[model samples]
Each structure stands twice: as C-alpha cells, then as structure tokens.
Target: APLGISNRDFLQQRKVIFDFPTKGVTYMHFKSIEHPEKPLVKGIVRAETIISGYIIEQIQDDPPITQLTVISQNDIKGLIPKYLVNLASGKAPKQWIGNLINGC
Candidate 1:
C-alpha cells in the first residue's frame, strides 16, 4: 500500500483485522474481497500480534478505499484496503499523524 502500488496488488495483499461484532471473534489477514466465480483465501490471522508500522495508499473511487501494507515479524508482507479494516482501536501510520491532527 505504499505510494506507488497498483490497485490489483493493493487489493490482494493489504492486511486487515476482522472483528465479528456479534460473535466475539477476531481475524487478521491479507484481505481479499470475496469474488463471485472463484474463491480466494482471506488471509486469516490465527495468533496474537501487533503491527508496528504501516504503509497506506488510498484510492478515490465511488467508494473510496485505502490500502494498508505491513511487514510481519517473520518478514512476510500483507496488504488490505481501508474499507475492509476495522478502525475502532487501530492507530494510523506515522505518515498520517499530521493529517489526523489537522482533522482531515
């Protein structure tokens, strides 16, 4: 989700933490939106982890989307878009600090 990533790759590799609002379950993965014809793996997070840094790139479509990229402790890379992210308790990347403070 860096500044110059393509939309296809952005959608395929962004990390997302999915919290089941009513089920009390949490899942984390490199999110891939479900497609109609073929099924793609939704990177499911099975362990507890904290993401320290993120590279975010946003796309302004009819429904704007944000791409989130993270490098895991094991050196694995993951990506997810903003719409798929649950921002309730998550913090924005360092690059976004100024924008957040400016109320943008």
Candidate 2:
C-alpha cells in the first residue's frame, strides 16, 4: 500500500510498491547506498530477490560504524530514481549532495 504516484513511473505504470512481508521479516525502514537522499524508504522487504535488497544496521552517529544487519532486500527498481541510485552507488555527480538537499 506504500505505492504512490510520482514523476518517475507515472507513465511507465510500474508500481512502486511490492507485495508485503519481504523475506522472513518486514522492513520498517531502509537506507540505500544507492539512494542516500531517499533515506528510510518505508516498505516491506520481499522474501525473494534479496541480493539486491537493503542492508540494515545501527551505528553511533559519533564514530558511525556499528552492528550491520541485512534486515531485508527489496526490489526497488523504479521506486528510486536512477540519478539518486547513482549517487548512492558513489558514481554521483559533483552536485549530488547539493542536489539532494535542494531536491531533484
């Protein structure tokens, strides 16, 4: 039910939402290295197609590293814009951060 209308898939007719209860656990939030700006995309982690799923972890803000967990992986193909994904994957443009804060 998290699906909604957006410019990304408005004409493609691709649903941003996937079926619920991804994997054995339900994802409350997700942080993508491929879409850092799109932080905490709320949804369920699918049971299948895990390799491309999200990795979950709790870390201290001070030092940043902590216990990392692969909470769930999702098929967020069209959900996250490719530009944001590129940013998340480190292939980001020079103004990625600026663009993120300023909104794409």
Candidate 3:
C-alpha cells in the first residue's frame, strides 16, 4: 500500500517557499480600479532633462512599464497598487515641499 503525502511534503516536492524581495519595483504600470469606463493606466519611466538652466521636475516616457505589460486581467484580481493604478486613473501623486530655511 502507498502512503499519502502531506501538504508540507507536496510543497517540498514542488520547492515552493515565500522568499522573494518585493521592494524597488520602481517601474510598473497598473490598471484603474476606480473608473471602469476609462482605459488602463500607463506607467511612466522618469528621465533627466535639462531645461532652462537647472534640472528639475520629472516627466513620463512614452513606453509603459514592462513588468506591468505582462500582467493580464486575471492577474489584477483586485485593486492594484496605487502608484501603478494612477497611470490609468489619472490620479495625482502626493506632493510635499521642504522648507530649507525652517528645516521642514
């Protein structure tokens, strides 16, 4: 008679584990959850551009995030990451200015 295998045994056999880095995913396009009527958000890649005289402000590139492109409708099960979703939703990002004089 053959013995039954446990969940752990199955996992071990499959070599599955929750050991992966989830940080520094800088570039990624996310779909919109707020407005279904609108199109999917496009992720923008930031680049340096010299304007006027000084380097300031960032702009979105034409190409969307490569990682996001792989994601299918089914992959986006629920509300996706806010940053990524912003592209499609046309949402504004949080802004904060520091006061050098006051040290804010």
Candidate 4:
C-alpha cells in the first residue's frame, strides 16, 4: 500500500540465506491478514505481494546493478472507476521499487 494511504494489516517474512553471495534473497512471502486493530477506512481492500529476490549482475553503473522482480496485485472492490484503478495498479510496482531504492 502507498504511504499514508490507509491502515492495513499484513504479514511479511524474510528468509536469510547463510553465507550470502553476490545474489541472495532478503524476503520470502507477504500477505494481508485480518485486522486486529481499528482500521481507518470504510472498507477493506485485500492485497499481497509476490517477490522474486534480486540477483547481482556483473555490470558497472552509476547507481548499481541488481534485478528485483515483484508480482503484486490488489483486489479493490468498490465503486471506483475501472480506469482509475488500472492506472494505480500499473504504478504500484514502480512505487514499490522506488521506495526500496530510496530506503537503501
């Protein structure tokens, strides 16, 4: 979910690889779960993320070389316009990646 967008409950797990290599995983799975606290929304939109850990590449660049693949989807059921939802869905990946990069 986007920052400061809504209150959501989710579970995320990371698998640590022993003797890490140039290519390794930092997370395993993630899924939305039943909210235990009071949510700040009228309705709930279940979401989950499927990630393919990055692989370090033998390339030199100003930023860095790493491949991170993510399969994320949102099941927004409401009176929102289809086009608007589609547009937001398309930008989700970029937003996630950008957040990750900026964090590092």
Better of 2 and 3 by lDDT: 2
- Candidate 1 lDDT, 1-104, residue by residue in tens: 33543222222334444443223233344433434554433543222233333444554556977655544332123454544343412443443465644895
Those runs of model 2 whose alpha carbons end farther than 4 Å from true positions after fitting are 1-42, 45-78, 91-104
lDDT of 2: 0.36
Query: Which is superior by TM-score, 1 or 3?
Result: 1
Predictions in order: lDDT? 0.40, 0.36, 0.26, 0.52
Best-performing candidate as measured by TM-score: 4
Name the regions of candidate 4 deviating beyond 4 angstroms: 1-23, 38-64
What is candidate 4's TM-score against the reference?
0.53
Off by over 4 Å in 1: 1-52, 74-104
Candidate 2 has which clashing residue pairs, if any? 22-45, 22-46, 23-46, 23-47, 33-88, 53-73
Best candidate according to lDDT: 4
By summed lDDT, the worst window of 10 consecutive residues in model 2 runs over: 8-17
Which residue pairs show backbone clashes in model 3? 41-87, 41-88
- Rank by lDDT, descending? 4, 1, 2, 3
